[model samples]
Target: MPFESIQGRGATRNAVPARFNLPERLVEGDWLDEVEALDGVSQRRTTITVERPKSILTRNSSPDIGFDRSINPYRGCEHGCIYCFARPTHAYHDLSPGVDFESRLFVKPDAAKLLHAALSRPGYDVAPIALGTNTDPYQPIEGRFRITRSVIELLTETGHPFTITTKSNRVLRDLDLIAPAAHRGLAAVAVSVTSLDPAISRTLEPRAPAGLKRIEAIRRLNDAGVPTLLAVAPIIPQITDHELERIVAAGAEAGARVAFYLPVRLPHEVAPLFRAWLDDHYPDRAAKVMATIQSMRGGKDNDPNFFTRMQGHGPWADLLRTRFAAATRKADLGTGRLKLRRDLFRAPEGRQMRLL
Candidate 1:
């Protein structure tokens, strides 16, 4: 059977002459047949593209999130974590939130420029700006683009306070800037460590730095006198949940001053991608994992309710929370109250002119 290609956005036709008509949304996974029949398909290398958003900071009103304004220098994280909650955001650009979300990415080349402009606005209130909120600002592409670094430099120059959340140790590269900012009460960082198991880290967050390296990053940041927090996010029930205590213990050992965790969220396309990942990696335990998730999600794949979304409700969720609390206490993480200094915020010079 000769392969037939389908055209733009319509019902999928038979790619293999007459194998059988599958749904337009589904395509057969026969690489040999595809290579033999299509020259163009075989010649493409997945390349990264730059997207110039007119603005950099995104405003949000969700009660669950702490920040009102956040900046993401890149879209479609290269870390390729199958459980990424930000994956569905790609669909808004008419791109698939699956493979395309991990491969075909968009970097905001003008991110630093736009951020300077936004921050310089006369009415721009100086609160702690959040970075790596939607997509990781320090993801792999950052090594080349260096947009995240530029933004950090700009923030530091203006004496602005900011917060960062990232899973990659690549953030350490900007320590020269971050350390000084921390000295001035202008910065805080949260390093997200999902699991201590290297193998699980590999499959769960395929392209992110190894867990050990992230621990090292935590150590390095804290050693430099930077305020560091350990984020044990997306505690997948029955799967990675068992490692929560170990992860928290390790973070405390590495000198993390604070710790936090959130339940796994599956919004839109992410649900199917995560399910597929489970089927591929942990087929035997997939059903139990999802059942546990459902128990927390009010008997569904997810619960989008604001506060409920971050921390699910149920026995499993409750137990996970209790365990995390106990482990952090045992490890002496966050021994006493610590808070980011908002008093250090000062409007960057020339904000009014820049906004104009």
Candidate 2:
């Protein structure tokens, strides 16, 4: 693990993905706070770079994913969730999935323009375009850039249906617009509440909203007439899995219409990073936790097959699914997939020209 010792960030260690054929480096001691006192570790500050991509809509026909298209307003999330599957994407740019992924971020300022152009293209078809499917769209930089707001505004104006997933209450800032769109069957939201335990949340997802805050956000969204769901995502097997039922119960009590859960997944660089995190935070149970994860993932760190990837396999996976089902039923929260209307989608009219 070159550049592997940088500690105290979301990832305990990291290196450039081997696929790039780049040589990696190692630190003897305290390179950017590696192998130093916990308090001495440098704070990882976030830097957002603006990008003007040619397109904003990403299309995929994967059978496992509900939506056909999605828009990631940013690349490299600052939320710093250790288990994030999207972390490997940063490796494509010669960046470490460790500190770089959390400290360095990229945002699309012209996302609205590209989205409008794509929607207006000839032969464009309508489907609910998903947000926050990769990097969280509501990550803290959003407060300054407001890129997500522009996206929602464009969608609202065109009557296009969309689904947003987030762990931030920042989405509440757009409640006035979201409530209207949701009323017209054009918008929905899912708030990911990974753990109700403040300690676990602080370590696992340092920058995401606290669990109760997310639940409160769901309740508020529902009260405002937005269809809200609870996402108990990336459930750690030996760690947070036991909280599945409680998570569902809490969210349902808070007015979430439905609940969804996915067992922890360790894809590519995420596996090693996660193992290091386990060793750092839970040294005693690290081996057992990895063993249990491999068991659920069919003797591998992860199962990449489309159908099996989300829920996983084997006894642990089955038990989790059963527990989730039982909890959702007991709490009377719908487990059914949310289906947003695509018929309401229409291209926005051309931007009005300003007099010179």
Candidate 3:
């Protein structure tokens, strides 16, 4: 009945109170009036488990998305960004999108093997496979698992092209692999810097790398020849939207080659979670913010329309777009999309040490 809350976490409340396929409304709240909270309420600890999926690449047909194939080495994210569009996804596992989404992670340690097999398949098309599309591949768990690194190694060995999106400075750890790949026209990186303000960023995305750190990450990536791009995502209408020009200029100063922004998307369980967050952090502007979001979403919390979903269609959306365009223009930040080479792809051959 109340917001999903786990004291030290970013999400103020558990948006998905009940597990998927098991609605809480099915049972009366009075029946379980004595139900108490689970453990780790104040301080959540990370739990990593392995998942060996049958396939590694997930293909999508979304018109707004540039890439079709994506690789998610993990099922849940640890960054704990309250407004993460991927939060609702944790519900499929019958888990809370709030605390569980960040603390309980599902890793794919065998991702590299599966990817190698899939790539070796006959007639398999070669394209730039995106990583961290669903959940970040370089979350803190990565330090122990290194699955993302394995994926990169495999792609590099096979001469396949790929791109990665992350908010962590951890990408610098793999500069060795990424730089050479970039030189070979096989890799690019997108660094997500949500807000420049540390205080806002702390509440907006508690576990993600800070805005200045991420800007430095962009700098290091570009300096290492990785062709870094800045992603100022989920431009919350009244909250972080005002920082559009400042963010763009900051990215350009860090040597980012291109920059982009996306208006906040509240889909499925994310709406309630974000609403709870707004109430907790920006109580005064919560109603006004939601009002603007609804206006942009056609009087709803979300709009799943094809083109409208990416950038809503309305006066507010138009103004946001115009602002983004102006900011990018002023910063000289638009260089078009950097296309990775498909021609360089090479599948392994047998007897070449059995392609080992």
Candidate 4:
């Protein structure tokens, strides 16, 4: 059966992995087809589930990425980016890594409390807590739940340093909190812009803010004295690769101090989902895109090694790096890293500490 692209959703199918032994879902009878024929495909409304986890801070020892500790106020992003590497995480809950990973969302309402508890520990180490590492902290639900705002408030009060990476302009809504933190050298923001063309962006990131809005957000954040990094992440081969230089120049025009790019990574479930997406939307060039990606990835769908994973291997990868460096230089956007200050961190006064 051919996978049909869902309107306003990224994944072409909602498929559960075989490792979980979950039964495959199929519409039971012809009645569904009759209803669809009459009324067209029904829209998939997003469902939010509140999760109260014991810990809010996730610590990682991976040497590939910069930060060691991070916080994700939500799981399963609704932005519906088909290339999201985090999609496979949905499998742990016996859920499909495809559409279910985007529609069946989870928010941590108690994230602030958990963060407070973690920070108040006697021997808590102070390091930058990365937000939006696994799932975007500023996803649409944050506007309703305010869980991410609460976490940021707690961090701000304690003078702890953190970084935010998001594709939404909604981060501007919390500028009151973030501006002060940036002044204290305790915060920075990275805005990810996948494509400048609205049409390409619509299908590539169905629910994310348009590229122009995100670019404007970079300008606003910079005007507020917040150091902004423009991230042109997951630069898909034969898809949005042509816009690399234009994106960098736009970021520079918007006052982003630094810029970076990553090649599209198709690890685990993301591979199949992205392939399906290409088949549906770009059938004419899907094979070419995948072949170019494989050539860059050393003839594999993805490279799992630490260093090579971030920087793809082979000729195409080298060319991408060269182009990125040249583009950044041309745009006057520094390739230097943004360092968030951790010296100003103050542990929240715990109950036992109050007695002292």
TM-score of each: 0.86, 0.92, 0.91, 0.94
lDDT for model 2, please.
0.85
Better of 1 and 2 by TM-score: 2
Per-candidate clash tally: 1, 0, 3, 0
Worst 10 residues of 2 by lDDT: 26-35
Off by over 4 Å in 3: 1-5, 15-19, 23-42, 349-356
lDDT, residue 254, model 1:
90
What lDDT tens digits, residue by residue, belong to model 3 across residues 12-70? 65445553564432222332333355431223456677787999999999998989999
lDDT of each: 0.79, 0.85, 0.85, 0.88
Model number with the top lDDT = 4
TM-score preference between candidates 2 and 3, better one? 2
Error in Å for residue 309 of model 1: 0.7
Model 2: residues with Cα > 4 Å off, grouped in runs: 1-8, 25-42, 351-356
User: Candidate 4: lDDT over CA atoms?
Assistant: 0.88
**CA lDDT of 336 in candidate 1?**
41
Q: After superposition, how far is residue 201 of candidate 4 from its true place, in Å?
A: 1.2
The order of the candidates by lDDT, greatest first, is: 4, 2, 3, 1
* Tens digit per residue, CA lDDT, model 4, 1-356: 32223589878888887877876653222224434444465455677778879998888899988999999999999999989999999888777888888888988889999999999888888999999988888889889999889999999999999999999999999999999999999999999999999888888889988999999999999999999999999899999999999999999999999998999999988998899999999999999999999998889899888989998988999999999999998988898778888888878876656553
